[model samples]
Target: MSRTHATPVNAVDARLPASGRLADRAAFEAFRAAATRRWDDLWSVERMVVSVGVDSSSLAKGAVEVLAACRRELTGSDAVVREVSGNGALWMEPWVEIKRPGQPPIVYANIDPSEVPALLTGSLEERALGVRDGDAFGGIPALDDHPFFRHQERIVLRNVGVIEPESIEDAIARGAYSAYFQVLFEMSAEEAIAEVTASGLRGRGGAGFPAGIKWESGRKAKARPKFVICNSHEGEPNVYKDRRIHEGDPHRILEGILIACVVCGAERGYNYIGGEYPLAIQRFRKAVADAERLGLIGQDVLGSGKSVAFRVRTGGGAYICGEGSALMFSIMGVRGQPRTKPPRSVEEGIWKRPTIANNTETLANIPDIITRGGAWFAGIGTEGSKGTKLMTVQGPVKTMGLVEVPMGISLRTLVEDVWGGMRDGSTFKGIQTGGISAGPLRDDHLDIPVDFDSMTELGGMLGSGGFVVFDQTVCVVDFARYMTAFNRYESCSKCVPCRLGNPALVEVIDRIRLGRGSLADLALLERTSKHIIELSLCGLGQVAPMPLLGMMKMYAEEFRAHIEEGVCPTGTCPISVAPSALVAAD
Candidate 1:
């Protein structure tokens, strides 16, 4: 289905103004009103309507005007423009086409949501009258011109919301290889690290460690045959930011890794992906092939005197794989488990070589930093954090999708304003930030800015952009237990503390929920939790107790009621069905 060529504009991107593509609300409203008036002029012949994304057989609201403008500019007369409502949601509906005096109107095909209520449900007096089978809706008409889309966006997320994942050329046009080209042609080993350092970018896959620091460590290490690893192992339960980046912008990650290889003088780079992300793996593999075909991944890239090869390595669906050292072990065909520090992955990584392991998002940021000057890239986010952060807004929100926002924005704004607040118009209860490792925050804490240090102040670190919101109805005790169970399952059994600690902790919580718990059970949980946090081998085990600990501090009554009366105050636990545990009448 050929569309009448309209470009898209992301309403939130700050770069839009620089490119002169930002649309004023009033001008856009005028365009919409004019389009509606044109529809009123020809309400009889056309019968159907639709809209879609810019690339996937969809039209911008301005596409209709562009079409009209094109017709008038070329043919110089008014085309009969009839708007018609289609049968389904706007994404699936067909575009309602206008007909020239005697010509028949034709509706375009394959709209995602076919329902077009705006044009269909009105009397002429009420201003809702639409043409028969031609009424359409969901049109944002100000962004149809192609020049609005010409900026080169680098954050390993260049392809998202811009092109269909299946399209290959979209990646090519987005400046995906400029960094790789620089690494191969313009930069030497130390020079590449210097450029990255100049960018002031940190690892976006959480930890917020400086990317240049990691690269510098690996570059300066004495170990021969250094390694560069792309950590695609997204093990967080609700986190999907990495998976989307790997799937949609594979070349960006590839380019980043290639740059790392050049800077560290390593001959090989490995992409370690999580087992659960099947679609991500498939898309990345195809992207690898596509990059190789274009001389971006393999030997002698773009006629430059540098060559490095890369491959995909899969992790066995373990949350621990997101940890840097654990991923290195998994890449070496061992169980995905964390190792002790003193010799970090930078000094001694896979096969005991000088390895630089970075998360998928961090690597994705490299190309853009190098291609665009570091100062230019650094100016986007807040002062400390120098780039836009990608976050997955899910659970009890009006719009549940991937979004990238600047660092200083408050969490409340992200939840209440950006996501349109709670789901189903329900009251906002709490939010679980940073997956299982993150602490839960009630409504009062939502105002915390979502940067690394700010979130940590509220007992929640910016773990990995997984912002799972809950409404007032969700039970805190049940939520803790559910998360505790996940921690138990994902614990790498290398250490006795994490292995024995998580399961034992799960059982204690289970007993409390079952009405069989004693007051002593709470004491045991308190002591055992402290021991686990202090004695666990790696960050996973240390952080696993966070949810339970947070609940004990934030909602202690919920826990106490479960243990003291066997009745879940929130009515969440199945064992709360019994009545004897309830306090007898005094």
Candidate 2:
């Protein structure tokens, strides 16, 4: 945003650092002090801030009109109706939060224009979700105690509902660049990488590789102009965590990027977001520009003499582009297809230089790791998988929303407790972890701790942390066929296994779904799925058949019902025993 459009609420005042480059901690402290005062003023009885959740999810549910309604209603009042980002409450959107002078901020959900009056007048009791700090608005529970949000750790989403997504001041007031500032003045690159490594943050983008190990490789390489890329172009079905972070907590992601740049000595950084996320892209673009103005990201960042240039590259919404090498391919202006890696991305990535690619959620953890020492983060979660994970629990879950919980929590806890179980009295069937290409975990597997090794031990990749919960209304065979079809449609066509094997698998499942399948076809599916996993060139192909295998292995009775009885056990698939032509040919 330009100076003309800047207001006292969003703009930086003269109390900040005199130069774009900060010389010492004292300068930053001055800025923080001013920001704190301004921030506190917004919540005071004198001013009374009415922050509206104006994120992408809320906007879809008519949040703009709600915001407009708040502005119209509080036109002459001392209350300030400001726009804040979403807290990932998808089912409870159009949130209206009012911070009364003596009381804590009360959050009311499903707030429409019609409820804006009741909200300001404190008559909106039924729409109340909870309170951020509980003064009891009609006895709604505290968010810290809410069933859906109680277990969430909230490191990545710390500023989500607290700050304006577009306001750098709001971001700063809530401790955005403090970690980066600390890193610039307090720690060496080696020490920085050690902090992350000690924190045990694995890559949140599919392969759960240790992030510190990748940074070490990137730093040790005898290469010039190292690069850091944030893969926000998540194309997995029913996964919206990346877009949610990008749109709601963009500065957090950017701060993580800057920290990575400092550690890896990268001169350039790229946030490869998908084009489908227009709001995220727009907000991120503004974030980059604003940071450059504030000297947060430039040749000499905050006078630390460390230079970093960051840019945003939007993809054309290809699922394959979510893969690391395929993302590198897209960024290079080439066909977004995966290539075999010997010289991994850390050794040779975009433009064939040493690069470190971390996904949106992975990088978002960096700033926090730096702020509160590495050991602090390592203390959370299970022994192997440390720290928290930002997860999107979708499908028919009762309280479907984005949650940040420590790793090693069972899917049973996530599905039953955090997300409030199945919606509409639906019986639990299974779950699809990661993308459509991941696990369709059964009821037995619900007790499995949701860590990388545990999920992988069950033959599923915990990629992207997007869990698609299903109920008894879904047929395992039908779900496998649909997921296989998705893989078929999204195959990059570079390799035969993904391109050809997906269609072949789709045909077999289709036949079974339509009641034309023989018992022999199940064996054929098992063989082909294994074949795809073994000979596939990339992660997409490698995991494409997981759904088929998961259903076949875990829910064999369902497949048996489809083939042997010529019927769907759940009565979800449309069975037609008509003779069909072979889909064996190209």
Candidate 3:
């Protein structure tokens, strides 16, 4: 563990103030008491800390070459390297951790960069993977008893992977704008909308709805120029937990969208996001320009004359701009689709006036329901679904990453006891918790209960969570013709049953997976999936035929074995197709 060189100014970001602006709430509680004394002197105990995670799936599995091999091997040693945030243990990509000085934090996994000098000489205790608060070091086990983070449950990923996200003073030294400094000095906006309607909060971007009745109807929509966007436009398809909570805690959803722009008086706000999330739009535009150069959000903010203002628009690659009046008409640049609701973006939005979107995990659970209230965040989950959700699992789960739990946890305990099942001898065959209009549970609907009215009572939903998984090597009629060619190429076809019933349910699930024939083309793929779910306009042509009509009503014998005994039962579809070297080159 060679590191005797003590001098690397602002080691990796946390010096904090470059300009000015925290002129109120007693100068932001004396700048969060000097950013909690340099975040407890960067984790004291004679210093050694380190961390190194850097997300986006650990920067495609290397974490920037383990943060340039921990600054080229703990540059001068007393070690306190930085760049944190990927604690979802993404199947252990790069990762790291350390702690030392008297030991405690440990971690290590999938290392490399020539194994960081044999992981600083402890010679990589078999790539650790444990040891957070104390004990179980080399024998590796405690990271809350591992098993991919034993039943997750973190509140908005509590300072996601432990702070340093482009440091807004390490997120106000880990307390980040104390609930926007008690709603900018001792509450009101109707007690933060009655503590987020006593915290039974919803709309985790899958339409659970009730976020304090959509901010008290955008604070009684009398409208003096209200707005609050943030629907991040995350073009779904196995979503990435709102791109890892916008690269692990973008100022906790920008202090829950600046407490929903002070309970909806909303001077302004926006964060449309998706341009395929280039690192959550380059780490939320350096956290809204270091929270607007410390005023803690533009003008009179912290000094509390009460203004508001936020920016970071980005998105243009539309997935119907992740809906919500097409993400407030793609932040007003327009043509992002979804409209006709008489007057609903909290009473006419964007250029018409009042609005309030809130998605990235529902404004990341509104800064802990305004710093620990609302019955302590509605005493955690279940009961019309409160608190945590995040989810994102992905395929053959033996820890595919991201999870937060607590909302009537079941899906057989988030895939067999918190992500530790289905990767051995793989053959479970079902799950798709939500995304691509979900609904495909199997294995007796894996014990149900994942909230949002028990996944909308099994017609299936709980969407934005995006679990996925599947097996027996997949082929439910070519997975309903690749989810109807991805909802007919992201249908913003304005309307007309998704502009012609999702290309006629992808040409009747591609002539019933190829072997042609048909009971009237399976009754015209069930009445063109009930006329595109009864005349679709929005909600993507009404759940784009709920995953090809829930895989023909639960794999109707794998769509009558490729249209009446032609054969393809999990042989991954083939039936009467050309291939003996393409029929001897035809």
Task: Give the top-scoring candidate (TM-score).
Answer: 2
Candidate maximizing lDDT: 2
TM-score of 2: 0.94
Report the C-alpha lDDT of model 2 over 1-586, residue by residue, as the tens digit: 1323224333323333343544446666777677777666566534456888877788889999999998888765546678887888887788888777767788888887887888888777677677895545547678788878878888998888788888777788888888888778789999999999999989888788899998898878778889999999988877888888877778999999988988888889999999888999999998888788777888767667888898899999788998999999999999999999787888889998988999899999999899897899999988888889888877788888888989988888999999998778788888887677666787878888887778877766577788888888888887887788889988999998878998999888888888888999989998998889999999888988987788787788889888888888777676732345323221
Cα shift from native, residue 280, model 2 (Å):
0.8
TM-score of 1: 0.75
TM-score-wise, the better of 1 and 3 is 1
User: What is the TM-score ranking, best to worst?
Assistant: 2, 1, 3
Q: Write the per-residue lDDT of candidate 1 for residues 1-586, one digit (tens) a residue.
A: 1122121111111111121111333332333344334334333323222222221112333333433333333332222222222211122223333233332332333322222222222211132212222323333121111111112122555455333343334454445565766666666667777777877788877788888888887888887878899888878888777777765566778778888888887878999988876767876888777666555556655556567788898877678888888888788888877889968877888899888888888888888778776787778777777777777766877645566676777887777666656666677778888877868888898887777678776677787788788876677877887888888888888898888998888888877777788889888987888888999989888888988887777787877887776677767675656544533111
lDDT of candidate 3 over 513-556, digit per residue (tens): 66775868877877887888878877767777787677777777
Q: Compute the lDDT of residue 207 as modeled in candidate 3.
A: 75
Query: Residue 555 CA error for candidate 2 (Å)?
Result: 1.3
Clashing pairs in 2: none
**Residue range with the least summed lDDT across 10 consecutive positions in model 3:** 577-586
Q: RMSD in angstroms, candidate 2?
A: 3.5
For each of the candidates, give the backbone clash count: 28, 0, 2
Residue-level error in angstroms, candidate 2, position 538: 1.1
